[model samples]
Target: MVLRVNGLFGWVRANDRRSIALFGGLILAINVGAALFLLLPLLAVDPDHAPVTAWGGYARRYVPLVTLAAGAVFALHLMRHVRSVQRLTGFAFVDDADEPRLCRLVEPLAIGMGLPAPYVGVIEARALNAFACGLGRRDAVVVVTRGLIDALDDEELAAVLAHELAHIVNGDIRLLAAADAGLRLVGWLARPPAARRQQVGALLSLPVIMAVLPPLFVFILIAGICGQAAIRGSRLIRLMISSSREFIADACAVEATQNPAALVSALRRIDGRSRLNHLPPGQDAMMIDGASEGGFATHPTIARRIAVIVAVTGSMALNAPKRRDTRSPDQRDRAACAIRTGVFGAAPPASERGTPDLVDPGDARNWLGFTPVMTLGAVLAVAVFLGMHRHDLHRPAALAAALDPRPAGILLAVVGREFVCNAAFSSVGLALRATGLDRPVGCDAAPARDLAAAQTSGSVGRFLAALTEPPAGLSMHPNGTFGSAPSPATEAETVRTRRCFRTKGYARGDGGLHAVDAPPRRDGAFDIGRWLAGAEAQAVQTAAAGPEAGDRPLDDYLSSRKSIVHAVDRYFGEPGLAMMRRSFASPSHQRAIGRLRERLGDPRWAAGLPPVRRAEFTLLANSPEDFVTCSARDRMDRKATVPPT
Candidate 1:
């Protein structure tokens, strides 16, 4: 048993060094990658530039300067609140004066371990958990939740305190603190751009909107990708710290206390209740029992820890406390209040506690969060500069054109315009429909001769016209005929119906009566309306062309026809109607659409059309099937009778 424990201790020490080295390497790699990304433009412009050549010289003059600056910033930030356990957990430090019993238990354990009597704090949470955190012995603090204190007997509590003291002695606190610092640094780097300053008036300034949006999107995209990488790196560092340290600490606690049974009993008591929800991800390693159990878990399962302890101690039966401490409410409050005031009398003198090397308040806020406007402006300036000097660099003309700021800006503007215009059209149409103002027009009878003439045009042509030409509020009749009607007042509603019709199986040709295909329903139930509609269309087709006209099977024909309905029943029956409504109701979409309309070169494109007509055109233009439905075959077939304006 002694041999095994000694072997484990040696293994843990070596692993700890490797973990630290791995973390240092991760930081170096990240810094190097960032430096390269920032200097890419310079390197691309002239690899032989004097400053670049000198920086890349054998001695590497600039590397140390960059390293020093980064290290200094990191160290300063970490030290600013080194003793912040109380601040983070909202637990006040307790000394012997506050709770002599609790402090007495911890003090003897610290003395036995040959370490300073660290600060002891108690959380008000009901979860049974305890953790030790600090840079080293002098500043170390042990925090236990109220639940843990009330659950365990004196022997069990002493064993738990010994385990935490072992962490301080083993320097595990410093290692965990470094991992936490790395995580915080990554979070600081990846934070989103601050909100833009608002204008005084009700209306927003167009110039400001245009200037902010593209850069905002670019920053988000770039920062999101980089942030993910940093997060993964931090996770890797924690994994490197390994769960072996937990075993080592457990072994040391048993050695110091010489009571393996008490430690095992403490483990049993804390088995399922040691998780602290308020603690962040990387800090789980500091807990006696981590928040989770898996391959990635920072601590071994409670059962495994106990088994190992029993095996090492060669003990079979263990005695543990069954009942919790039954202290009254007044007693608990007195204990809490005593701890809260203990620090005031016991705190070190100002002169003895050296000034913290904290980052400047103004610089910390501005730099860590990132000044979006200024940062974006600088990026744009660099891009513009590179574009202008691309030809002189003797690079490919294509590369220079790609780098040109004008094309990028124009592309973003055009996309933003289209998005905004579509949103506006959808929003206004929905508002009109919701208020019962824009009602759909009733079907008006059209000449049978006109319907025949329209059908005579190529099927492909009819299909294209239905898609490309704006919705004319045309209705399909029961008698296999068409009727012209006034454009619906609720254009979005009508457009949505038409869209649903196409999606269900109605094809553009054959006066929108033929069903090309029927999509399978998720519920696996046959649609009766679709089936009936298919039978009616099939009968009409059979009558027009004799029984043996087409060789297609009857089942296939019926299946296709099953989805083509003449009424708005098909639209209302759709499952995605509510989702569609919510999407159109989105304010961002509306704002984008408005911006798009304002940026268009030709006012007549949208402004000349009535609101309803404008919405119909916008809906058609933005439909996913527009390209395929409005094909050249349909556009060129001009013989089809057009709907009356």
Candidate 2:
């Protein structure tokens, strides 16, 4: 236990140092840009200012001094707030049974090291992913995805879980969260809104400030660009930090479990199965897949990871386990039942519910590097283009005289530049919604059309879609035309009609357009409105309430929750059961069957019929668990596949 704790603590220290070093260069660069923002203002300030003359032109200047101070404060405030946000996001945990296993592992390790047990939670996702979150050891939570649980056997699962614990112990979670927060802060600062209002206010106070302000603004803009560049440089460093942490975690996990073979085999199988296509950026390092290059992604390559595990242990079992032949039964009834269900025709007994010794995380790996740089590069490229246009706006009169049709090049340039910046901002906005941080203003479903397009297509896709599509129709009433997907004209009308109140924010009388001043609603109210209504919520609640019947055991609950796809592919895939065949006629039909099939995995023992079906097969429940009551009307069949009344 002491050893585990020390190991984790040492890991955190090492990880932090590496991360700090990686991001150090970027921070310095950002400071340099920020420093310019401060220094230029001093130069702009009057030479006669007291500070200028006080020290014989040494330390007396004020504007630059003040600006520098202000910039620092701004940066610091942003850093602090963003850190909190990142930490909070990391702290979110899923409440489930797997959490106990994590606690068990961490507890022993913590006891060995004289540390407290860390909080553990499950993420309700199919993706094989996991991450540790907290500002520090005492504050952290380790979250693993359900897909990971379903994928890895025991030893492998333990390895991945241990790796995350190592991150918490080493302090990698806090460090990375801090770094991400800083980057996000800097990006937010560089946005036009943060500065635009200030610039306008400054102009209002002293119109002459505008005269030299453009140059000043230009300088600040360059500084902002440099700041972003620094951030990118910092991210590169953090990647290396993450890699080293992975190495240490692997070593620590082996030491803790004393089962290097499990870790090695886990890595081997996980390496082959991982995918990189759906990895969410910024959080890639936290995933078991570690990008795609094996571990070199966020950790290192699987080869490197495996080699380390092997070196730490001794020669592992080289022979692969014999593959089990597909089951063949003479009776058509058994085969048909298997086909009608999923891969797992029946739930494994409770004792066999989980692998006791697996050591891998999962197969989905992230090989691609962190992309903050790419995003920054794109933003800078657009800003530079826009700045050039601003220069054009200055010479619009000259260009007008040169060309017959007054050169709207300046107009085009300004619009184009602003468009890029706005698009980027909008993309960020959409991501916020997806992450459940905030909702878009004045949108019924938050119009997330741009967000949807981005997710389905790509960032560029989102930009193009937004560019081609007109502003969404505004609705004065909650259930107005804009509530549903409608014609372009209706969309246009909604936008036009609601344009007046769009400025008012989300109020009852007007459409629930969000107030800019308010933080995004956390209840996911906007999306909830779009998806679940009174009837929908009631229905879901009723179903989720569990078998209207009676008491159910743990095994029944676990099995019932398993995906029907697993059972259907296992049972119905065979050429026997007519009912199962009719159910799984199409992939879409198969998916529908899978959803319903999940409930059947549970054994409603309280109803007390026969033990064979209860022990060997799962029974459908009204909700998560029920022994007696079930919705006779198949909800999936009635609503999903069949027409509604």
Candidate 3:
């Protein structure tokens, strides 16, 4: 027995060291990964943007600082979580005055183990469970549910107290507390951005949406990936910390009490009844019997624990457990249905029975009892919203100016610049400054130049001109309207004009002119409202002109609207541009476009067009509303086709 005990002690020592190392390594990896994630976008954009020395310096300065900060935060969070657990479990520290029997049971066990008597507490729960928690020996606490005390005999109760005392003596309490804290910290950090959904939805202004969404989405994606990794890593660490400690504690309990039979009996009584349904998840590691059972279970099964105890102690009682409850059905049902009424005449409602009143009255859920932490989160959210909207807030005049189309366009351009060029440079600059590598770069001037060019260029006017002008192969009729097909001479001119337009950056699908002089603003900056308004006006005018004018007026207006839609597409770098080009090159699209032009030129050619030609023409003749609706539908269709980052 002595040899077996010594071997278990040795194993415990080695496993403890391994658990600590794994936990520290996981934290270090997380800190390093965070730093790298921050720098990833910059590196992806321009690999040679920063020097090797700069990166090395960044690691040397910030990695340690970040690790230290993380440690400090974890420590604070762990302490707070410990207190929260105590509160949530409705356990209060007791003395000889509050519970003479419980204190008397634990004090002797502590003395026998050559450890200070840890504080004793009682949970109001009727569940048969117990757990030990603390930072260290001095502040350690052992808590038992009332159900446990009432269910077990004096010997069995002493064995359970001895088991908890073993945890304190072996320093398992501290490790368990740390594991609990880590699991919660990772979960809270990695939680999806549901709180910000309302804020994002409230951003009705186009400029605000444009300015905020890119960075916000980037943050969410990176946080989501890192959060999942952290959560998994924390769980693995908790499992490692907990897996062996329970066995060692169980073994120690038998050794301390010198009565393996008592523990075996206690285990048998407690096995299925130990799970506390009111207690939150992730507390399984600390409980006498885990609240859950799975492959990833923190505690060894009760049967496995009994077998080990028997092997080490050679206790015949453990191997001979064939006892069964002999109570009558009525008596058993009454015992099972018993509820603690405290000092009251009858038990409160089921929902209000077990848990204690939370420190915060506003906290309706026991799980979210950390009111101060929630307040801090709310403050952080407000700060982020304010930071993102600083541009709009500081320049209220710009928002009012947006009512005018030209200012609105310019304001959009500015926001786009901030989103794309300025934000990138700012992030890089902050990183460089942190690393003491803040040297002036030529790239600093690029955004300013782009903003200036956008402000000066008559791109909107050129866009409108491109939309209103008729495409080649169409001729003017005697009524001063364009609705006639070209002559043979004009057909050759038409092909030449089409070839020239294609070379000048016109998409064949809609004959929309792309701005070649100015670089395409990939940051969605177009004035959508202005375009929609123009389309609506054109639709009204076409309606007033009536069917007497044939489809000539309708065709002209639709074609113009399509041109503007494609121009916006071009501005946003035309997602799926390659697919669009391939489609336009197909023989089917060619025939469809030819038939569409004929139908536009002669309203009476056919009362209705074929589905293929109609669909193709619809693509080229949609108003702003139709364009938006189609774009949304197409995006949904192509959602699966988009590659994962």
Which candidate has the top score in TM-score?
3
Off by over 4 Å in 3: 1-7, 29-58, 192-223, 292-296, 316-446, 449-645
Candidate no. 1 TM-score: 0.44
lDDT value for model 1:
0.52
Q: What are the runs in model 2 whose C-alpha is more than 4 Å off?
A: 1-20, 36-106, 189-225, 272-280, 292-299, 311-314, 317-645
lDDT of 2: 0.43
Model 1: per-residue Cα lDDT over 1-645, one tens digit each: 244434435646676677768778667544533443433233323233313233563125445665676677667645744555445555667778876767878988899899988988876665667888878789888987776776667777888999889889988888776665655555444443332333221112222322333232344444445544554555566655646667778888888877778888888868776655554444566778873443235676788777777765665226433534445576566545544543111222334333333211112213323344544544554455455445645666544333333332322333333344445546676775786543222212222223333331222223323433434566543222234643334433544444321223333333322122356467733444354444445544433443464323322332332232222123333222222333333443344334334323356655755554454345433542221112222432443556656
Per-residue error for 129 in candidate 3, Å, reads 0.6
RMSD of 3: 25.2
**Model with the higher lDDT, candidate 2 or 3:** 3
Candidate 3 on 45-138: residue-level lDDT in tens? 3333311225665666666776687678668856665576665676767899987767878898889898888888887665678888877788
- The alpha-carbon lDDT assigned to residue 544 of candidate 2 equals 49
Report the C-alpha lDDT of model 2 over 538-603, residue by residue, as the tens digit.
333333444653334333333332323223222222221222333334344333234445545443
What range of 10 consecutive residues in model 2 has the weakest lDDT sum?
500-509
How many clashes does the backbone of model 1 have? 5
